[model samples]
Target: MKQSLTRRAMLGALGTAVAATAGCQSPGTGSDSGSDTGEQPESADAVAQSDSVYTNVYQEVADAVVSIRVYAEDSRGGQGSGFLIDDEHIVTNEHVVAGGDEYYVRFADTGWRTASVVGADVYSDLAVLRIGATPDVTPLSFVETEPTVGTEVVAIGNPFGLSGSVSAGIVSGVDRTLQSANNFSIADAVQTDAPVNPGNSGGPLVTLEGDVVGVINSGGGDNVAFAISAPLTQRVVPSLIQTGDYDHPYMGVGLRSVSPRVAEANNLDPGSGVYITRVVSDGPAAGVLQGSDGETTISGTAIPTGGDVVRQMDDTPTPTRQALGSFLALETSPGETVDVLVERDGAQETVELTLGTRPEP
Candidate 1:
């Protein structure tokens, strides 16, 4: 089962979150990057500004931004936020309502209404909700472009129980991988500094123009915060809302970036590709592929290893394991077979390995 995010843990595949309903400060104060107390630069000219970017953004998105409340057994319910993608559908992190509990949605003006999960994908950390009643709500349009570095964005949610709180910041980085509470890596994420907190999970990370670009997920380490990208969400959202799983190719070898020392000891080019750090015993790569074995020393550094150095995935060259993982997701499927090129013993060879099911972790 997915652990609740409130417990400072999460279930595998972006499981549930426990939102806060009370005990929070004004939005920007909780996170240092979002300093609410700072005075705004005011212009003396009459009627400073109107019809600006963020104008009506909150009002437009508020009807769509819902307060999510979930109830589990043992009287341990959780809280989080979600946004409506359509009048009837909503998007949120899978962790917002994991464990198949009863869920409800509360609007800015309305009371709680029942909600049901349409579909959820753990690999992508996305879920869709069907609002029970046909309440009038405005859905935020999604931004088309992937957010660029230094792009201004806003974070909106009920942080630590304060509803209707919003903060602003810029895109810090992209394609970041963070370790989830369950010790699994949430890959290809968007990093921001917009003050995401416990209650902010599953809320919208919108543009200055009010278009949603990502879903706020987590924060830590000085001013670091992160979200799952909207483009990724767009690619996987439909399938997740319709099916509980997102299908992708499964390569059975554990891999890592080939370090300089290991590559030299193995008589291979380190920067040229990723190294298959481990192969599951009797797994797909065991009989068809060759890899490192026994102890080797280079530059007086000893390394115990076994597995092949991957030079390419199909037609694309992969220089790191993370790149290989992203590549695999793009061009493979479960139960498919593909040619893998590997370098072993100062020679390059190719072998076809049938993909296998990703074992439960």
Candidate 2:
């Protein structure tokens, strides 16, 4: 399991480290000890070495990160962060530009420039912005490989209107599911301990090598924050740019992960797969997939029974709701036909279903 630090504890530890470091230096040993000059007490070399990796990443990527200010039709406005993905385009969260009549972005090297929403996808919480011209900075690229747990990462964004802010921590979890609008969940998310707050959304969560691994999504102020994974972003952003929207494959069915009680009620292996609670009438899985036909009580808890327990989709094991959502989001398209393997009546069977485009939220 990953370790966590409360805000008070983290600050306390920082204070202790500072105090211990100060105590380590001899009182009259440094060259500027007796001087009245207000320069830094430590040599430039020492300061550079202390935070070389973070410093280098910040210098390399900060120029391309932008602060976004959004103005709504009714004089309401908010701010968030984003980063350039190309010479003329920027990537941000869909929620950031929602209900905005005007969008403006400011780069570290340039003044605020007018921008337009080229596309936005609420399902994935990703949006693309087009600017007439951008500062002479290289666009950030997503990491080619998935970052493993404990990989060092940084969140670069404007938090609470503070521009050019950077926070550092390790990737604490992967393949996480985050709640989104429309009662849906954003799947395959990356969780980090990097301190992100309001206004950090839409910014790049990059690795030490300056490659973006995720897009900063939300933070709970409890040493926990989440980002849309780079793999999902890569899938959604291109379609948004090309067509002004992205179509998500939809399965119109309510699902629940198989828990101990649910497993017992449904006669399933404990904690094995996802259960289909209700399949929408006339929906993609209406005729092909089976939903729960009865309910039972286990330990005074009502559990849906007689439902299809989905074990796999397209040969990919969907052991949880997160795995199922990720498979639909990343591996299939709106019109693709996928093989769904489910255990029904204590027997396993495979069924093919053509996916459908998700309805507007």
Candidate 3:
């Protein structure tokens, strides 16, 4: 079941707290007590100018952001946040609506409305919902370019059921790999210092200019939080809207970055490329690529050897697993043939492998 405190009741409680604090003040310290400090208050114009960016962004975006409450079959439910992408479509985290039997959404200017899940992708943690009617609010758009590190951004969501709340931070890192289900990783994620808490997932992490940079995924007590990158969102959301699910490109091979130990045992340059640990039988890369066939003890540590080191994929240098994963996720699709450059037997060769759709988790 869903629950919320009315805005009027919340304001009334705040007013009582303020009155109590005022009563506790000393006699001569009141605003009209004639006891004045040297500094004077700034003018309204000055304050307005200083806060214009954040205030304007909130006004532009908050109306489209909605608080979502989900009820499941067993009478258990929780809340999260989402934002409008179009007239009747809302984008949110897949985990937010997972296992829910009924869904309700409340916009800033509208009462709760029934919603239904259009599609959801667990690998990307993105979901789409459709409502019967939508308020007249401009749908949010993703930033055309990837936001650089330190670019100021805002997160608008209902944190801990606090509807229409906003927080500010900067993009701290990008191209991050977030762990997902079944040993898979969500690549090219954005990291931020924004104060995201429970109930914030599925909301838009937007630039100060009101352009979305990422979708809020998870946060912790530490000053670190993460979002699904805009590029990936741009790729996943449309398909989710058209179809009930999104298919992720899969290679079906276990990979590890070639560290110095791995490189030495495999007789390759240190930190050169990604090493193939195990290739799935009868999978996409089964006949095209070769996995490690032997193991060697290097300084008492067993290291897999005799594997094909993937140097590049479709002209993109895969120096690490993150790079390879990103390339596969953003650039390739299922059934697409990709040219893989690999180092085998101290020589370089190109192999073509057709990608496959990922299996259900």
Candidate 4:
């Protein structure tokens, strides 16, 4: 799907051309644009089964979807999609309410109602908001486990203010790491080919049975879209609702994945690992994890050397950037210390440091 927020503005600019041709009534002669006559419908039995499943599912969950419009400084600012998790609580993307001082939530059952931001976690790109009052709205349930790859999934949201739009696709992949607004990567993302446009962010990516498996977040190349996994959402949303923030473990060190080429150039083992390039002063890794002490050129390519190369963290061996971030985000909480094994000067050494909280950006 296209990014609907920007698409909405662009569609407005083409109104004149659309209007000029609005009166022209050439049924078959105008264009063969939307009609693909070469394709044929499936058998009656197949079509009936498919229609029954999706129609029944939509009827059960359609009431939970709503349209969210953000207002900045008493003026219409931006718009996106969101869904009710409870009578008073709604979940959406953090960027939706990042700048808005006021919010207007519109639904089919209940009209517009004022809302206030409860909490927003930038690291996860998820936010919670409390409306003025509770209504008789049905909340969607996130599944306990993620759906398998290639399983069919459905997307529901408001695209360009068209409330309650539906799209269907399959789970393209699982356990993806997507970059957040703050430059920190959010781990365990679910990737799908569903047409999730701009307004679809914060909506539900539900199974055929109407169970929420993910939250539609952002659109990427082709029809590829990324969503926050239901497992991650379940883990983070409760803390956000209760405490207004979620704590993530911080190492305060810049790490890069060591490839085989770089490892060979440094005259180290062929197995790849994580290299510490820089350590923030006064931060958790400061004085504990050494930064690059020198630079060397290997085959016309300059590379940093003489830094701590992480071999393992606890039970993990030769972790990449994704592996390390996932362990910190999912396995360990703030203030928890993990045993770190590093290679310094061709010797194995152990370092123990208490994990700290990520400071505000």
Candidate 5:
């Protein structure tokens, strides 16, 4: 039997490319407009002033961003960029160093150092490296809060292995669910259009003030780019640094968003919750959440009904599979009881299951 690669694994290795050359809005996405010719100010200083917003941000951040060149069994090797998080650690996308036997770090001054993967988390597409502590190398500050839509952002990375490359744009969206190289859907990713491309994965997405808001993860389609949020990094990096992995609570089940047709067939309102699709055998959820079996027709379509619809988790409403996964990650450990509200038999009931820890990739 051939083993199938998970979306998370693929994304961890390549950062999920936008699926098509076409488009997908991903819920809250919208188009942005530029200033019209008439709205443009005549004074050069005015234009300079707006442009200056990103000047210091990039200068201060570029020093922290370093080129990562990974040498694998495959000939030419691969290249990406990462930023210094501290004297001893460098952060980059897991894909950058994937399948590598050796790693190299290069600085803007043409300085180079040998490096190794301290740890990496494929599910989050984050990896860290250990290099000898160097002086005068400043780490970029992380954003304390979520970046808002329209906030000016900048991307500094090694696009196509070209170091010190910089591009600018605004926060295009927030909280998007996208597949990681590891086949797991990374919840709440920050999307930007800072001209990110291959080799940009693992770079820092900085705000106008130079604070790191997100880590570059993937790019494609309509010039879109995605990054894992800083908060998610805050949760995963320490563990990766210490153990090379982070424990994620698991209640083994496959799920999908509840569509209007699914809602109507189940006699529930559409746009309300996520529908459970399958339960992994012997998993934590198997004994806690009951599965229903039937054949039902919705809008002249026949669909199998086996799994339950999840409405909430721990009193927190989970409207989609992404929301459920996000909530699960927020919890601390395995054996911890979390309340899950499910829809069944024309009613809602809460089931408490002690989540189990999934093995790290």
Candidate 6:
């Protein structure tokens, strides 16, 4: 269930978000050479000169932007933003189109066209839409290189159903981890401070050069929003457009990050790594990684004891779940064999496991 951005609320794919609505919410240094240098102040008399590049970018992409209204058989639905990826395909958040079986996409100049879902990936919060009618604006272009922090970004979406609304800002951060609407992990997400209201979820996060860098997904706090990065979009959209699905690598285990108190109470190293709480049946970790064999009391509570602690993966030290997720999402594809270093019994051992394709949730 996707909530309106106006509510400042989020609906996860696998879990429910209990927080209240948040209010609505960078320069390119080289991809990795510099960080965002906070905004500069201008004099009162300066009518902030409008950059010609920005105007050209907007004029180029605006006709490609559309307002998506999704409706179920029961007539229940909500609106979100989307942009044409090509003549017939539009990209939007999975959450935006997941609720309804039918859709109507309204373009800034072309009025409305019927559309159907090509595919929706809950793990990445992305969906591909196919419209029968031809698009008015040119297809969006994406740069393969990552957008660095502090690069100027422009977001054009149908915020609050105001068609073709645009907001500008910088890439605040990158290579971030965010929980998907489905309770899974999305690695290498981009963070921005653009004003993203309820209808901006599927819009394009465009660079000053008019390249699509990210897909605006959701927002939190004041001017803080998260987007699915261009890399993931580039990787998954082709599969979705062709096959109506995408498969991701999966370990299939429940993990809990080690804490100082739990480690000290169990006489184990504190902050050493994450614990294997439970391994799914027939999952990649099944019969390879073991959970706690017993219970241990710590801080007046009995916590699971004797579980295998995973210290690293594929020769890289993944002390945290975030690190592990980054490796799985960004580096490896399904069917790859990886080495997992675990602390079991007393000594350490490396376990070899073949990654599996994540089954549809």
Best by TM-score: 2
TM-score of 5: 0.83
Which ranking of candidates, highest TM-score first? 2, 3, 5, 4, 6, 1
What C-alpha root-mean-square deviation, in Å, does candidate 4 show against the real structure? 8.7
Q: TM-score of each candidate? A: 0.77, 0.88, 0.87, 0.81, 0.83, 0.78
lDDT of 5 by residue, 1-361 (tens): 1122232222222111121111222221223323564454345433333323334455567778889989988765788989989888999988888899989898666578899898887878889999875548677779989999988688888888777777778899987887864456787789997788898889999886778989999995576899999888888899999898877777777777777767766777545787876777798888778654675986679765656889998878888776777777654467888888888767888888888877555
TM-score of the candidate numbered 2? 0.88
Comparing 2 and 6 by lDDT, which wins? 2
In the range 1-361, model 2's lDDT, one tens digit per residue, is 1122223222212211111111133222345543477654666645333433444566678888999999998998889999999999999999999999999999986888999999999888999999999878899999999899998888898888888777888899999998877788888999999888899999999987789999999995888999999999999999899999988888889888888888888778656899999999978988999999999987787888899999999989999998999898889998899999999999999999899988898
CA RMSD of each candidate after superposition = 9.8, 6.6, 7.7, 8.7, 11.3, 10.9
Question: In model 2, which regions exceed 4 Å deviation?
Answer: 1-48
Model 3: which ten-residue window has the lowest total lDDT? 14-23
List lDDT for all candidates, in order.
0.69, 0.85, 0.85, 0.76, 0.75, 0.77
**Candidate 3 lDDT over residue span 261-352, tens digit each:** 99888789646799999999978899888999999998999999888999999989999888998899899999999999999988999999
Model 4, clash count?
A: 0
Which 10-residue window in model 4 sums to the lowest lDDT?
14-23
* Tens-place lDDT digits, model 4, residues 77-179: 7777777887788888888888898888887567888988888999899999888775666788888777899977778887666676677778999878888
In model 4, which residue pairs have backbone atoms overlapping below 3 Å? none
**Better candidate number, 4 or 5, judged by TM-score:** 5
Off by over 4 Å in 6: 1-56, 262-272, 295-304
| Best of the two (1, 3) by lDDT | 3
Candidate 3 global CA lDDT score: 0.85
Model 1 TM: 0.77
Residue pairs with backbone atoms closer than 3 Å in model 3 (clashes): none
